[model samples]
Target: MLEPRLRTMWLANAASGAAAVAVRTPRPVFADRTRTPRETVVASDLELVTVTDHSAVLTWTTRARNRAGRLRPVPADTEVRITSADSRGAPRTWFFEGLRTPYHYAEIRGLEPGRSYRFEAYSDGRRAVPARTLVTRRSGTPESTGVFTTATPPPGRLIRTIALANDLHYGEPASGLFAGLFEGVRHGTDEYPEFMLHALLEDLRLPDRAADHLVVAGDLTDSGTAEQALGVRAQLDDWGELGRDYFVCRGNHDVRPPDETDHWGNVFHPRDRLLEYFAGGLRIIGLDTTRVRGAGGTLAPAQLAQLGELLRGEPERPTLIFGHHPVTRHAAVSNPGGPGFVLDRANAAALHRLYASAPGVFLHHSGHTHRNRRSRPDSGIGVEFLEVGAVKEYPGGYTLIRIYEGGYMVNFWKTRSESARRWSTRTRSQYLGLHPDHALGSCADRNHVVLRDFSGLSG
Candidate 1:
C-alpha cells in the first residue's frame, strides 16, 4: 500500500481534473436505437493537466443527445477508462452516476516517469469514439510539456526566497455578484478556482528561481467551507511542505453568518485559526481579523494581547505581519472611506503605532482590495503596507521576495500561464467595466526594494 502522505498528495493533486481541460468541439458518437444508427454521445476537448513522477490528471466534456435534440451532459451513468498507451498495465477507471453535466474528470496514478498513456470514455457501456494519448514528463524537467509537471519541491537552506499570494477567493461561485454595492464590479470568469491555483503552483516552480517559502495573506476561501479551505491546503501541500515552508490566514470572505450553511446543509465555521510560525530568522504572523457581521473586521482583545506579547518577546527580531484587511485606508481617490477600505482603522492605527515603536517590524501585507496599493503609516512608521491583487481574478499573479544579508527586493510576477492570463483579461469588466490593468497598477504597486541592516536576523 502507498504511504498515507503520498496517497493524500496524489488525491489532492487530482481532485479537480475538470479545471485542467478546455472545452473542445464535440465529437459525435453513434448509438443503436431500434436497429437504427442515431447520434448519441459527444465528447471532446480532452486535456492533460498535471503529470507527476507517478501520476497524471485529465479532464474533458462528455455530452449525449437529449429529446430536444440538444447535446447535454450524460445522465444516469457515465464512465471513463484510462490505460497505458502501450497496454503495459491494467486500466484505471472512473464511474459517475445520477444526473450529470458535460464535464468529466479523471486521474491515473502509479505510472512510471517519462511514460505514455491512453484514455477513453463510455456512456452506458458504449465507447465514445477515439482515444486520447498523454506523455508524462521525465523527472527533474521544469519547462512546459503536453502533460505538465508539478512544482518542484523546496530546496535546502531555503530562507532566502519567499513568495506571497493573497485574495484567492477559492470558493466564490461567481464574480460581480456584489455589483453596484461597494466596488460596483460586474465581471467574473467561469474558470474553476482549482485550475487557477494549479497554474500558479506551476508558474512558481520555474527551474531557475523557485520560492523557498510561500505565504498566502488571506481570503483563502470565499464561503468559509471547510472543504474549500482543505482544498487550498492540499494545493499548497503539492507546492511545499505545510506548516514548515508555507503559512496562511483568514479574510472577510472566509467568514460567513452565524446561521449559515453550505449547499450540503453543513453549518459554516472558520477553517484556520490564528497562525504563527518561525522560519528563516523571522517571526511570521497570520492574523484572523474577520468579524461576525459586516464587510469589515476587528482583532479580538485576546488576539491583540497575543500580538503585543509576540512583539515584546523579541523587539529586535525581524518580523512580518499579514492578514486579509489593511490597517490604513488606501491613498487613492478611487479608494473608499474608512472601515470600507479598512474595516478596523482604530486597531490598525494602534498596530501601526506599536510597529513604529518596534523597529523590528518592517512589512505588513494584505489583500482585501482587489487592486494593488502600497502605503506606510503617515505617522512615519517604517513598516511597508503592501496590498496584493487577487490570485483567482484580474492582476493574476504573486509577489516574489528575495532576502539578503543587507536588504530585500520584491517583484510581482504574473501567473505566466496563457490560460490564466486569458481569464484575467476576460474579467476586466469587473468594478463597472474597470479595465483589468487597474488591478496591476504602476510599477511601484507591484515592485519594491528595502535597504535596511538585517544583520540582526540570524538565518
Candidate 2:
C-alpha cells in the first residue's frame, strides 16, 4: 500500500541499519581502551655510588603519584635497558625486568678495568637520564689501553708510589661564608657531587700510566654525618678500584660524637670507622687529632711514639703520612693565633724535626684549609709536604701525582663542568667581596704543574 518512492527509501534505511548493527555487535571500538601517556613524571634521589672494578651501582626514586592518580612501578611486562661505553667509545648493553618500588636500584657489572664508561638507563623503550661509571684495573698492573696509556717498564727494581691529599671541600653549603678564608672558590650546584667526582675520577683515570696506589689524606667528609661520609666513600671506592690500591686517613669530620651513637655504638672512629675501609699496601698512620680542643691537629703522645717506632722499624718501602691538620708553616692555610687552623707551632716543629730525621717518610699530605701547595721543610730532608685542593670547592679539582722511575708529575685539574663552572664564578665573586685576605697563598695560583725527571728513589 505504500508509495513506490517511500518504499524504496525505507528499504535503504533498513539496509544501513543492518550494516551498523553488524559492525557494532562483534568488534566494537568503544568496548576496549588504550591509556594515554602520563603528563608528569618525577624522578629523585638519583645516585651513582658503590663503584668497583667490574660493577657500578645506581639508585633512584620516583614520586608516589602521576597526573592520573598514582605512579605504579613499571610492570613486569616492561623491560629496563642499560647501555655503557668506555672512554674509547666501545659500547655494551644490559637488559633487566622493571622492578616495583618507589626506590629502584640497579647494579651493572661485566665491565672492563680502569675504563670510563658512560651509561644510560631505559624503561619501556624510553631512555631515562644518563650517568657515568668507572671500572678499576686488575691488581698489580695498569690497563694497557682505554683509560691508561702504555708505560715503560722499569729497568731495575721499580718502587711503586701513590700521591695522597685530602680535605678539599668542593660544594660546602657554607662555602660563601668561608670563601675569603679559602682563596680557591666554587659554587654548590645541584650536580656538585657529580662534577667533583668526575674531576677526581679523571685524575685517577689518567692515561699514560696508572698509579701503583692512591691515598686520601683526610677530612674527605665535610661533616661527620653518615650521608656525608658515604658520599665521600663512594668516590674513594671508585678511585681505589680504578687505581689498584687505595688508602684512607681519618679527619675530624670523619669522627662521630658519642651522643649520636645508638645501641650499636659510635658510627665512626679514627681507626675503625674511616681508615679501615681503604687500608692497602699504602701504610696509613691514623692519628686522632680531633681530641685536641681548639687545636688544628695533634698526635697523642702515644700516637706520636707509635708513629716514630713504625717509621724507624718499617722496611725501606715508600711511606706517606695523612692527617686532617697540617704540621708546618707552609702547610697551614691560616696563620698562628688565627683560630688555631694548623697544628700547634710547638707540635709542628717537633714533628718536622722527627720527619727530617726519618728517611722512610716520603710524602706528608694534609687538608683543612682546602688549597694545593707543595712545601719542602727547612730540614731539607727531601720529604715533600703536598697540600691538595678540595674536591667540593672552586678551582674545584684534585691533585694528580704520577710517580715514575726518576721523579713524579703533579697535575691540577678543574671540576669545571658547564653547570659547575657557572656556580663557581658566582660563588667566587661573592666570596671575594666578603673576605679578600682569605684568598692569599698558593691557592690563588691557578696553574697546573708537572714536575718531571728528578732521579732519586725508584717508583
Candidate 3:
C-alpha cells in the first residue's frame, strides 16, 4: 500500500491530467477561492514538435511558483526523461538536462518510421505529465506496399536534384530596422551555429533517399566577416562525408568591400574553397553580386559576359544554378528603381534570353529577398527559378523540393512555434515598425506560391 502523501500526489496528478483536457477545450476559467495543490505544482506549456526527418524535438516549461507561492527558477540539475516505444512495445528511455529558465528541451533520434511513441520528463526523479509523437517516414527509395502509398520509383537512372538554403546571416547584431521587419522573432536557446547546423542537417537529410545534388544559394555569412566565414566553414566540415558534391554560389555578403579588391581576394572566399571540396558530381558557378561603393547587387559587364558564356556552354547533363539574387521581377521585397539593384535588369534579361536559347538548364536556385517563390519566367525555356526563404526572418523556414521523373513538388516548412511566432511579431513591430499581420502576409506570399511545368517541353 502507498503512503498517504504518495496517494495524495497520485490523485493530484490524475486531476491535473483531467484539467489539461478541459483547458484545451473552448471554455472560460472559473476563479476558485481555494486553489488545488495540483494547480500550483503542475507545469504549463508542454509541446511535442517534429523538427525534421527521424527526430522530434520536445520542449516544455515548468511551474514557476512553489506551494508557498514564492517565485524561483526551476532547478538547473532537473532531469528530463524521454522514452520511445520500441517494436516490442517496451519503452526505451533517453535522458536530458532540464534548464533553469523554467524551460527544458530534448531531441530524440533513431526513431523507427511510422510508429507512435510516448514520453515523460521528470524533475528530481518525479514523473511529469506525458507527451506523445508519431514518427513518420524518412527519405527512402520510392516503393509501394499493398498497405501504403509511395512516391514513384527511382528511374534506377541517376537523377540530380539540389537542396537550396540561403540568407543565414550568422553573428549579425540585430539592427532596429531589421528587428522591426521580423517583429516578434525568437530564436531557440542553441547558439546560431548550432541552430543553423541542426536545421540545415535536417533539411539535407530529407532528400537523402532521392537527391543526387545539393546547392547553397547564397549569403553563407552575415557580415562578410572573416571569423564568421571561418565559423561557417567549420560547421560545413563537420558533415565530412556529406560535404562532398555540394555546390555553393556567392552572395553579396560573401564578397570583400569594393575598396579592398576587385575580386574577393581580401575576404574569406567560400566559393573558391567550396569548389575545391566538391570537385566531382557538383558544378558551382560563382558570381559577384555585391557593389563595392553602395548597397544593391550587381553583375559587371565582364561578369555578365562570362555568365553568358558559361550558360551557353553548360554540359547537357543535369545542372542547377545558384546565385544570391533572383532573376525574376517578383522576387524583390521593394520595387526596383534607379540606383536600386536587382540582378542588373539588363543582365537578367540577357540571362533569360540565354536560358531560352539553351535547353539544358533545368533549374536556377537563389536566395536573397529571404522568401520562397517558384516561377517559369520564359514559356520557351526549360529552366525553373526557385527563390529560397531566409532563415533569420519571418516564416523562418526552408523549402524541401523532391525531384522525380514526371515533375517535382516543393514543400515549405515554417519554423514558427507559438513562442517563436510571438517573438517574431514583437521583433518586427519594434524593429521594422510594421504590424504583425503585414509581416506575416509578406512571409506567406513568399512561401506559398508554387510553379509547375518547368520545361514547358512536355506540353
Candidate 4:
C-alpha cells in the first residue's frame, strides 16, 4: 500500500491506463537543494510568532515576482514600530530595524511583562504590511485588537534547557497533503527542510538561552531513504554529537518498505532501542514510536515491557519521554484527534499505566499533527502531554524546556533565520488558511510553566 499522497496519485495514474505503474516521489538531497535569490522586495506574511516575558519574535516575508509573474521571497531590511498606551495617554514605543533579508525575523526585546502591543512592519522602510495573510483568531489590520501581549517570566533559577523539535520531512516536495483530496504546498524557501532545521539549530545555540540538548521526537524525513536519514543526521551533527548532544526517534515516514532499498533502520535506532540520557540527574528518554509504513503509532509489547522495567527501577528520577504520536487524543488537545493521528487507544492505556507507576516522568513530547498543543489527559493528568509544531511547516520551530530546581518552563520558539521565517509564513496556506488555528496554538499552549519539585536534579 502507498501513502495517502502517493496512493492518490497512483489511482489517478491507474485510471489513466497505467494501472501497473508505481509512482515514487522523491526530493533532492537536503544539502544539495538551495533557494533562488529574489531581486525585489514586497513585504507580506507578517505574523507574531510567539511572545515571551521580555521578548517576542515578529516575522514577515519580502517577495518579488519574476518575469513569469511568480511571487517569491527576496532580501529586504526588517523594520517595525511597536507602541503601547501609557498611563498618561501617551504612546510608549519600541523599535527594531534589522538585517536585509527575505525572511524578516525581528526580535523585540525589553517589553514590559503583561503589556499589550500593536505594531506595523515595513520591507525596505515601505509600509508594506496589512500582509495578505493573517494569523488566525486575529484581525488582519495592524492596529486591531489582534495584537499580542508579553507575559510574565517563569520564576526559577534556570538549571538547564532542552530543545524539542520534529517532523522535518526532509526530501519532500511539499506539505499539507491529503489523500487525493488536496495538493501539498511547496516551501517558500526551496530547500525547506535544511532552511528550517538550520534556523532551529542556530536558534538553539543563541547565547542567552542556549539548549543543553536537543531531542527530535520523530518524523525526521519524508521518505525513509538513506539519503534523507543521513542528511538529517548531518544537520544534527552541525549542532552536537549524534547520540550525545542530540537524539532522534523514528517517525512513520522514516519507515522504509521491506522490499525497498531505503534502509532507514540502518541509520536510525529501532523502536525498542529505548534511547536514554541522563544529565545532572535529569533523565530524558527517546522512544521509537513508529511501525513500518504505519500512520498510527503503537509500542510493541516488548518495548512497553522494557519501558515499564526502566521506570520501575528509578521511578522517582526526574524524567521526560519524547515520542512521535499524540498518545491518546482527548478534548484537551486540538481537533486533529483520530485513530491515525495518534497511538492506538489500548496501547496508549498501557503507556498510561507505566506513567502512573512512575511519578518522575513529568512530561511527554510528541509530534505528527504539525501543530503546537499541550494537554494533561485524564489517564496521566500529572504528566504534560505536549505536541510541538512541525519544524518544516507553518510556525516552524522548537519548544524549549528549561528546568529549575523548583519547576520547569515549556516555551515554543519559532526559528529566527530569514529563509526559515519566509518559508514558515508561506506554508500558512495549509488547511485553506485555517492552519494557524491548528498550528499556532494559543500563547499559553506555546509558553507556560509547570511547578514541580525537581530538587534532586541540578540545573
Best by TM-score: 4
Query: Which residue ranges in model 3 land beyond 4 Å of their true spot?
Result: 1-158, 175-194, 202-213, 240-243, 260-284, 332-341, 375-380, 414-459
What digit string (tens of lDDT, one per residue) describes model 2 on residues 1-459?
333432332344344334433442222111111444343344432333223334444444344354578654332111123323324432333424233333344444444434455554433334343211111122211111212211222233334545455654423455544425654433334446455555555444543224556666666555556666656656666666522466656665555555563211132244423232222343545455554234356666666766666667763445567776766676554442343676666767777777766665666677666655565574667667766666655445555554545444444444323333334333433444432223212321322222333244533
> On a 0 to 1 TM-score scale, where does candidate 3 land against the true structure?
0.55
Query: In candidate 4, what are the lDDT values of residues 1-459, reduced to their tens digit?
Result: 223422332233233222112221111111111434336567766666667666666666778888898987676655555555333332222333333567766665656677776666666655545344333335533223536667655555778888889999888877788766668787544578877787788777666457999989888988888888889888888789877788888888888886776556777775456888887888888887777666878788878888998999999998999998888556224455466668877888888888998999999999988888876675735898899999998888899888887788777878765566657777777768778777877667887777898876785
Runs of candidate 2 exceeding 4 Å displacement: 1-163, 168-171, 179-194, 206-212, 241-244, 262-286, 292-295, 332-339, 376-378, 433-459
Q: Per-residue lDDT tens digits of candidate 1, residues 292-390?
A: 677676788787777888788787788888887777755323454345656466787778767866788878888777767776565787788887777
Task: TM-score each candidate.
Answer: 0.61, 0.53, 0.55, 0.80
lDDT assessment of candidate 1: 0.59
Clashing pairs in 4: 75-102, 76-101, 159-459
Clashes of each: 1, 11, 18, 3
lDDT of 2: 0.46
Q: In candidate 1, which residue pairs clash?
A: 185-431
Output the lDDT of residue 366, model 1. 81
Candidate scoring better on TM-score of 3 and 4: 4
Ranking by lDDT: 4, 1, 3, 2
